[model samples]
Target: MTLRPLLDPQLIYLEPAVRAYARGREILARFPQARQVEIDSHWRNPELYRAAAAAEDWLKLKRDVLVLGVKKGMTLRPNGRSADFIAPSSSNGCAMACSYCYVPRRKGYANPVSVFVNVDDIVRSLERHAARLGPKTEPNTVDPAAWVYDLGENGDLSVDATISRNVEDLVAAFRAIPNAKASFATKWVNRDLLAYEPQGRTRVRFSLMPAEMAKVVDIRTSPMAERIAAVNDFVAAGYEVHVNFSPVIVHEGWEAEWRRLFQEIDDVLTPAAKAQLKCEVIMLTHNEALHDVNLAWHPKGEDELWRPDLQERKVSEGGMVNLRYKVAWKRRWLDQLLGWMAQTMPYCTVRYAF
Candidate 1:
């Protein structure tokens, strides 16, 4: 598909000037003939105000209909340890522009978070596939009893600025699928979800980082405190809650920071809530290290971590270098993190991402 540069306003500077420029009105005027317009939430960064303004300009031009799309292929792909399926959501517009965002490097810098207005087509495709699989039977099972689907496996789900607009549609679509379990993974704390009754098999998974790390690297995202509080709210509403500490960036005092963060999570969870918590501690895998410097956080000697077995792929922005951990190191790290979790919250079950 041919993608056009709708606009290129400087995100950092233009955000404050949005009202002054009548950006929304300008967008409405410019793309009047366009079928749909998508405003990426990532551009909301004050540092990227110019970009945001450009996006806002386009959004205003067209009162586009928004539709959530689903990946027709296998949703679950292997990450570290657990496999995850792609749920129905926007492409991949993450609000937090971390220095080490893997999406740009591994998947390219395209606005994956843009709403797929062809969502109805996507659902129809899924229904067709299900019908082709044949009727459910004990000897030859085609229609599985439980289908687990994860949202935003390629990006964050509840990036407040975008989710508010798209979540209701996502909830409605997934609820229509029988025996389907949908999970949304996000770094932001979305309390609004608590208000909606659990529809379909939807679950909210939160990807948390240390408060200090989040402050330093997770630019433009919600704070750790808010995320923890939101998770508690989800749990109280009787929703399944999963915790992911993926790409666990190692910095000085990381251990202590992680310990404190987990403790905070434990403090808020009720006994039953704690039992339902599925926690995963994932270290940085090579697949996600492609756009290492976009957020400006790569180390000086990062090449040392590269391995020959890892695949190298060239993405839209630049080259991506991936590396897998040595078997021994993987086991060692998993042991250390799981051991810590056991000591801190013996009741919670912890899983390591391979």
Candidate 2:
């Protein structure tokens, strides 16, 4: 694969508290050419936040800005389906601009990748948390042998690996944890992570969609074909690989397109990958705030996302008003998609669906 810079920030927002950290110093040395601004707090950088919204091009701002801070609070929350718990974020935001991304909603106008420098602290806390949970006493769909942790709850670890050692550190930390596994969903195909040597301690869920839909919705992330092609290789590299059919967009002809996508996966995956493959199927859920944001930066992409006729209003657990496919319709669409998957890739297991 041809080498390309994973990140090229024109401006670096530095949190003074983190500059003394080894990780922070390494990042500064890596990007000496970029303009650096000292900020009081990573989350409270109003100037950068406003600039992100006011910028003429949203995607450009995402590519040009970076935030570095120390994650002071290390709390792992319960997560039943994707993992046993949502691990403390090693990072937040993402370089990729997927249209339906929820990360940007909380940050208002801007959502550039935020790298947390206190990774050693985060890892130590995770070890303590895992020790408290002890070994798994019951088998569940998430993992039969260990408690699972979603290490990239708010960001893409594969993309984060490009700019920081957090992914490497977290994966390495999990290797020694006897009863816990780290997992994250990502759209990027970063071969650098193949050297992390997870030894089945990390689960990398490659988020996927139909090729045509992905071309518009995934935005700046790896092409659908590349993600599919990398699955067997990642599995070979000792990481458990899973597929995520996330934010499954509902539209006319979506089923036929999905069928083609399933066929492509069945044709490309090696027997080894197919044997271990498990999937999480999540239908599209859109927020009004995100819809308004997309209109500013990527209006055309919204055409595939902001469909209200087939959707109904939803109040998210966080109390945000959102839109999702009505229950009856979503069930029907899910059933149809799963039926096709069973026929095309019977070996693949559906770990969870929503």
lDDT of each: 0.51, 0.90
Worst 10 residues of 2 by lDDT: 2-11
Scored by TM-score, the top model is 2
Candidate 2, 44-153: lDDT as tens digits: 88887778776376777778889999998988899999999999998898888898998888887588999999999999999999999898999999999999999998
lDDT of 1 by residue, 237-346 (tens): 75677777766754446679878877987887777677767766776555544334331333432432233443233333344445555555657766776777788888
Q: Which one wins on lDDT? A: 2
True lDDT of residue 173, candidate 2: 95
Our model 1 lands, by Cα RMSD against the true structure, at: 9.7
lDDT of 2: 0.90
Residue 203 displacement (Å), model 1:
1.4
Against the true structure, candidate 2 reaches a TM-score of: 0.97
